[model samples]
Target: MKRFLLFIVFAAFVSPALVSAGESGAEILKARCASCHDLKGPAPATIRQLWKRDAPDLFYAGNKFRREWLVAWLQKPVRIRPAGVNYLRTINSTPTHQEKTKKGRKYDVLWGAVLKPLKHVTLSKQDAGAVADALMDLKPHTALVAGVTLDTSKKVSLDAGEVIFDKVYGCTSCHQIEPGYGGYTGAELYTAGKRLQPAFMLSYIKRPKNWDPKIWMPNLHVSPDDLQKITNYLILLSKEDFSESN
Candidate 1:
């Protein structure tokens, strides 16, 4: 009965375009996304005075996330939180992923297999390629980093983006910026401003699969204004360095 209820809830949130296992995080989160992920701003804490909470925010997912990872993770969250973000068990941790032995509850996950679900409907090789092209297509806000020279119209601002960058989204963990900012799993993004076509990037941010099939990342609700900001910010970095055709 519980699982049946879960399935019903799952169908409500997942994208109709996505083919699921009929039981995957994509389905669950998509159904219940509004409860935890608020796009208007940083997700609200349960309390008026509280600023932090347990789950990660999804509002700024457009600015972060690798498309391939996002698709797979949604289809099978066994790699993202292992035991599940809500449960915190590491039930599916791969031998290759980072371990929690050193930090107790503070385990750091650096990498995992590109998710491949035995039960779910996955993107075909051709579709996968199209999606990857689309994902690599995202451009962040074209703002000036402290040391980088990413100024296109000279109106881009990274200061206001601090929350979206470091705290609200934790983008620095996977993506890399040139003068600074980066992570391990994703490609370098300092030059994302110049790498992608503005129009293409726009399509991808709005509908990510216009670029790639996700693995470790999940689709988060995004608004148009935020998309413009991230696009502008990425363009700025393009002034310093970037590539879209690759």
Candidate 2:
């Protein structure tokens, strides 16, 4: 009877602290992140809504992001998308024909605010981990990742991966395979392997429209083999040390 009473006392003392720890992170997210991130469900419904999005949707972050990456990134927050979240607001078409390499082809390039360094909220290590934990609890798209799995056997060489990303799918036209080596419209691909869950990457690549119906990324209609290859390539690419040369 005495031991039972002691156990109950310990539980009473510890439960509240555990709850408070989780709540602190959630409260921080509400106070700071809710203003910019979409912690709630259902992505932008219309083109107008999509254009208005100032940050990436975090409603499905639990399923999308790798926890360690989230914790680290939140601490030293940097811009992932070179053109910012809404390229429509940052890109401008130059009037001069010299801006174009081909006749009658005007290129829209990033300008103004996007060209400037990113301004984002930074959190302390403790707070970042707490917030990442809270964010991980917001998973609503579990179904998206349930059936997907990474197939490492399908891995391709870095050169082969580059060929697939650049020539086959033209992903390099939007996403960067290496720093400053691709278009600024999409988020940098170099970090995708470390920052995102492999299953999420596979599912998103399989059908991006399912995640965000109005997202600008077109359905590439990737074959199953290519899907595995691409996902494997991304995972392998993440292991490279780009900092060595830089």
Candidate 3:
């Protein structure tokens, strides 16, 4: 009878601790990621608000990211944007001496914090899986991605895709297709295939204002056929081995 009483006492003491230890993924995200990313949102209303943001919003993460990619990325976090989330904070407006040689053409260059290596929160494999699960649940923009259909039938070679991206759309002026290869004002395009969902990419490319009201990326009004080709090309490009070049 005394042993039975002792057993009940031990169970009462340990139950609370076990419950605390097994925290839900949502709780973990609220504790760790809520500070830097916007877990709850109506995206920034204006450019001023956009510039004020310190990190990317996570409220639409489910619609934007691939689950497997999110799981891996959370474990080994890296910078997706070369110029940081707010490029204005990292850019230097002063014209360099090299600009003098270019017929007095002034250019904004990335300096200060952006030139340094990216600093981000890293997670353990188990914690990363939990966080990814929580992020995947935040699909507020289902309507935006609904109409986007990735068509793989439009077969495009890498060379043809580069022509459309660079020569046709002039995307190379702001975004890089490879490391250190293109201009620096925008996010690197090389990793877009693996980092973002196909539907998000197509929808965003079709209309930038729908996703981000004040984003600088303009709506290029890409045709439906071209959009499919471009998306397919991005997916194909992600499979390439750029390690040797780097």
| Cα misplacement distance, residue 232 of candidate 2 (Å) | 0.9
Better of 1 and 2 by TM-score: 2
Model 2 residue 130 CA deviation in Å: 0.2
Ranking of all candidate structures by their lDDT, best first:
2, 3, 1
lDDT tens digits, residue span 139-167, model 3: 99999998778988897999999998888
RMSD of 3: 6.5
Put down candidate 2 lDDT per residue, 1-246, tens digits, no spaces: 999999999999999646654457889888888999889969998999999898999999999999999999988887899999999988777674225655756676677788777889888788899999998998899987897888888879999988888899999888988889888888888889999999998999989998998999989999999999998888888888887653
Q: Sorted by TM-score, highest first, which candidate order results?
A: 3, 2, 1
Tens-place lDDT per residue, model 1, 90-126, is 2334655546674554344533232332223345444
Off by over 4 Å in 2: 1-23, 94-106, 244-246
Q: Please give the CA lDDT of all the candidate structures.
A: 0.46, 0.87, 0.84
TM-score of 3: 0.86
- Quote model 1's TM-score: 0.35
| Collision count of model 2 | 0
Best by lDDT: 2
**lDDT agreement of model 1 with the native:** 0.46
